[model samples]
Target: MSIAICIAAACLGAVLLLPACALARSATAAPASGIPATGVIGIEEGQLNADYWIRQQSKPDATILDPRAIAAQNKRLHELDASVHDIEHLPARLTRAQVREWIEAMSQPREETLYDERGEEIPAATLAALGDNLALDTIPAEQATRYGMVVRRADLRTFPTRLRVFNAKGDSDIDRFQESALFPGTPVAIVHASKDGKYWFVVSPLYAAWVEKDRIAEGAKAAIFDYTRKTPYLVVTGASARTVHTPEQPGVSDVQLEMGVRVPLLADWPSDKPVNGQHHYASHVIELPYRDDQGRLQFSPALLPRAADTSADYLPLTQANLVRQGFKFFGERYGWGHSYNTRDCSGFVSEIYRSFGVQLPRNTRDQAVSPAYNRIDLAEGLSHEERLKIVKTLEVGDLIYIPGHVMMVVGHEDGWPYVIHDTTGITFRDRTGELARVHLNGVSVTPLVPLLFNREQPTVDRITSIQRIRP
Candidate 1:
């Protein structure tokens, strides 16, 4: 069976970890009866494939934004969005109040009841303990910001502790602690340490959260920035790729590189020399960051196989490329805050656009309100018909937002728009106009019109905004 079929079958009855078997049936077999057996209610035969959407576009290959245009857009984002921090230009010193605000903003107590993995209610005292671990009292009056580089793909947590919490009991897919993830070679400004000294509150370009200290290596500011700006880098274009597994250099071995992660290439390396026991001939020698025993930054050459999905630079921002990139993550499990080595809905869209050098805020709330793009705001007063009219005009790569989730428009089929998104589940009106819920806890493609945000409202009516990554 194909990977999608396996994923779909394995995910049956799961609340938030995999796709439903209905997806498998839709991809593979037709019903024995004369009627077509599309397991998904609205998905048609060819709709599962990315090529179908690409074929529908009149100018699929046309560049929506060239590199120069993308660079301009990124510049505008930094200037407009408070969330998209310009860490490089950040001052070396920060006030205690500034650091406390950043910590309190992310460490606020949850409003909803939370449960542990064992189905036990997480008590108020436990939540208080987690808050105490923030070590806000230890912030110096005049804090010095330290620079570091992410040595590996590391999880960014809402709290310093690794305790996993969930919205519902026995549903272990979405861990509430996971805020986001930082890829290798990414620069961060280390500001505060957790009370236990195991995690650091570092601010990256797109996110600010508590990441494990060992995953970051302290280094000089110049060296860190220079490494980021190094020429002839490789941009991970696939959903994800890993370095060659090496027993010799355990730190750099088998490191996962997610889509849009750029690593500087060691172009001048000697071809005869081996990198971490592997010959350099069949691989691209790239510079990777690793934390030494003393927790300092060090760069070493590592071999990424030539066959790995990577580009010399960012892909051209075009309609076809957008559809293709979105499909690369077609069956990936939904990972909240970039957990599980996968991405959440906003992260999925962010990474897709990042592969083309487009910058986006890390979270759905921020991305929806960001002023960097051409946005069509659907106010609460707008009628469902009015929202549907806007949805019809949505082209490939347009982002549709409703509260905490976002979806990327792929194409339209018979005037009903389709979207590819990372979601836990979707409720929609089935053929009989009755509500049907499908637990699709993965990256999936589905039509837009029939989806419901809740029992009383359709997804279109809930749309807060639609952002187009164009001039």
Candidate 2:
């Protein structure tokens, strides 16, 4: 065994303990999954395939995420009043009564008073203006009877505009955010629109939010849903990739798509028809959407070079591939809720698994608590050493979840577990045994032991759950 895998035992025995609350559980329990199992360290690039999860989910009924669990969660969600940010597994078509319920939930002013960046309370007069501008009276419940599809990576903002807003001075976390992003080919029900008609309030299977009008295309109820399930599609496996540009159709040309976005290939496209003056066979001729002169969504064909970063199917869920896929975003700057033209912590992990056909909730809180994942409840009252021991057993793809953040276990070395995550900053001790801080405002790798949440609580102590997407 490599030094990394063998470091677990001696490492745990050496830690000096002082806290009483951390001693309730022992880390020595044989892992439920029999881990410390060898992972392929350097598989050839060509070998990344759907075979990754075959061994892990080998049991007859051992599936990926549990559908029965999701169905039950959806049933509970159905009872809650829907918000623009609430995730409800609603169908592609919502009945009129359902639409009215959604409208009522979204149209009213927020129950609590809102504050601006200056920490000044928003005056009641201003709140009234916001309410009036919401223009709830104009929501054409009769006209919004179809489905929609997002054709680009678009933000889901608190309000329907491109205006940038912040929480407070020195806090540029993009307060206009709604913890969700709609990627290409995501199906939605066209529920409502902004008064200005510039943004469409649509609902995905997991979330509902306002996406820019130009980024979405409304289609027939059946077509929008069918478009996503079509076979022979390619999933973007790289951080981001663009289609080969075609001057004749600039709208659909050079289109940019992020990781896990899937689009179907035009299987019947003839070889002789060249895109950008080259044989079409050399590229994956795929269908994409663009807005017509009438501002309605329409489909068009575009070319993505076969050599571009994509896959024939969702990558297999293997330890080696998990490491490989996680490294693809090694240096990307952390985007809060997909802000700063990049992805946030949850977005980073979500995209990695999406390339492998796994679906996850959009936020760390929900993901940590979701009943579908293979959850290792490390809630408080357990011994810290027991928690650290569980941390050591974490495999390459396991998600080590702290409140509001997540990290993927890439590997271990010298008794130190390394993680790659999208985070704003981290605190640790320097070689001189002095406290230090590093502003890692993007996706980065660091050891697990030295990390401190708020410079005091060991990250392990605050881990509410260690969620495994697949057993």
Which number leads on lDDT? 1
TM-score of each: 0.91, 0.76
Residues 1-471, candidate 2: write the lDDT tens digits.
Answer: 111111110001111121221221222212342222111121223223323322333242223444454344444434442322332234444555666566555445555644566656657776565555555676554553567677777788755655444434444454543446777777777777777778777767667667788888777666666677787888899888888888877667778888888898788887778765657877898888776766666778888888889988777666666766787887787777787678888889988987777767777777777776678998689887787788877766788777677888766654556677786654443323333334456776656764444334666777789877664
Q: Give, for candidate 2, the lowest lDDT window spanning 10 residues.
A: 3-12
| C-alpha-based local distance difference test score of model 2 | 0.63
Say which candidate scores most in TM-score: 1
Estimate the lDDT of model 1: 0.82
Which runs of model 1 end up more than 4 angstroms from their true locations? 1-38
Each prediction's number of clashing residue pairs: 0, 4
